[model samples]
Target chain A: NAGVIQTPRHKVTGKGQEATLWCEPISGHSAVFWYRQTIVQGLEFLTYFRNQAPIDDSGMPKERFSAQMPNQSHSTLKIQSTQPQDSAVYLCASSIGLGEDTQYFGPGTRLLVL
Target chain B: QQQVRQSPQSLTVWEGETAILNCSYENSAFDYFPWYQQFPGEGPALLIAIRSVSDKKEDGRFTIFFNKREKKLSLHITDSQPGDSATYFCAANQGGSAKLIFGEGTKLTVSS
Candidate 1:
């Protein structure tokens, strides 16, 4: 198994620009999760999708952050009007079917907003 | 507020020695706790986990001691090695919830 695959190992965007990160979950896994990791905030949950449906996004920033899982195989996280403070490693993880299952993470996209 | 927390921002241990990493949670609803280990530039990987029903969980060299009443847990790595150097995160999730709350992490370094 290739495990989870995330595109653009690193991303650089200027202020006000938009950044879209991609994640392809492991085969047969029904749950996908997005998280942001920073020096100050540690690892923070951004959103989650189960079976291609958004289940929870309480941790997402109300305005510019958005995530979607169009199918069981992949999910995406988009950040609009990216600011310098938005720089962080965006990680994607997947599990068999959620509900206390083990989550396997991808390499992550290191986003650096300039 | 941080729902999950880890102690000792960083630690150093000698090879073959036992290394202990501490964690605590504020939410009593949290029933599943997992410890993730991350090397520089890599995403965290699950190293060990324990449910609220169990006080202790062991796997090879790693063991987790959980205290349900105190809302606390600790990861013990026996016979530590230099390769064990990494940041360990304590994460928690309530049953049936898809989201996982993570702690700030504890960086451990094992010297040979």
Candidate 2:
């Protein structure tokens, strides 16, 4: 298995620009999650989808951040007007089932906003 | 506020020694706890997990000792090796919620 595939392992964007990260979940998985990892906050959940439906996005920033799972096989996280604080490793994970199931993760996309 | 917390941000141990990492959670509803280990430049991988009903769970050289009353749990790595050095994160899941609450990781260093 390729596990979960995240495109553009690294991304750098200037401040005020838009940044988009993509994730391709493993086949047959029903749940996908997005997380951001930084030295200060550690790994924090941003949003999640179950069977291509948005389940929870409480972790997302009130503004500038949004996520969408148009279909079961893929999802995207977009940040508009990106700032330096947005620079971090964006991780994507998928689970075979809901709640407490083992999550398989992608290597992550390292985003740098200058 | 963070729901899960881990102690000793970093720890060092000599080869063949035992290393213990501690974690505690504030939400009593959390029943399933899992530990993930991450190497540099790689995503975190599930190591071992335990449920509230069981006081302990062992897998090979790794063991988890959980105390439901105290809302605390710990990961113990026996016969540690240099390869065991990595960041360890403790996570909690409640009921049927697919979401997890993670604790700030504990960085472990094993020296030969």
In terms of DockQ, the best-performing candidate is 1
TM-score of chain A of each: 0.98, 0.98
Each model's backbone clash number: 0, 0
Report clash pairs, candidate 1: none
- By DockQ thresholds, what CAPRI class is model 1? high
Model 1 CA deviation exceeding 4 Å by range: none
Clashing pairs in 2: none
Worst 10 residues of 2 chain B by lDDT: B93-102
What is the DockQ score of candidate 2, to 2 decimals?
0.86
lDDT of 1 by residue, A1-114 (tens): 998999999999999999999999999998899999999999999998888988899989999999988777789999999999999999999999887789999999999988
- Tens digits of per-residue lDDT for model 2, A13-113: 99999999999999999999999999999999989999999999989999999999998889999999999999999999999988778999899999999
Off by over 4 Å in 2: none
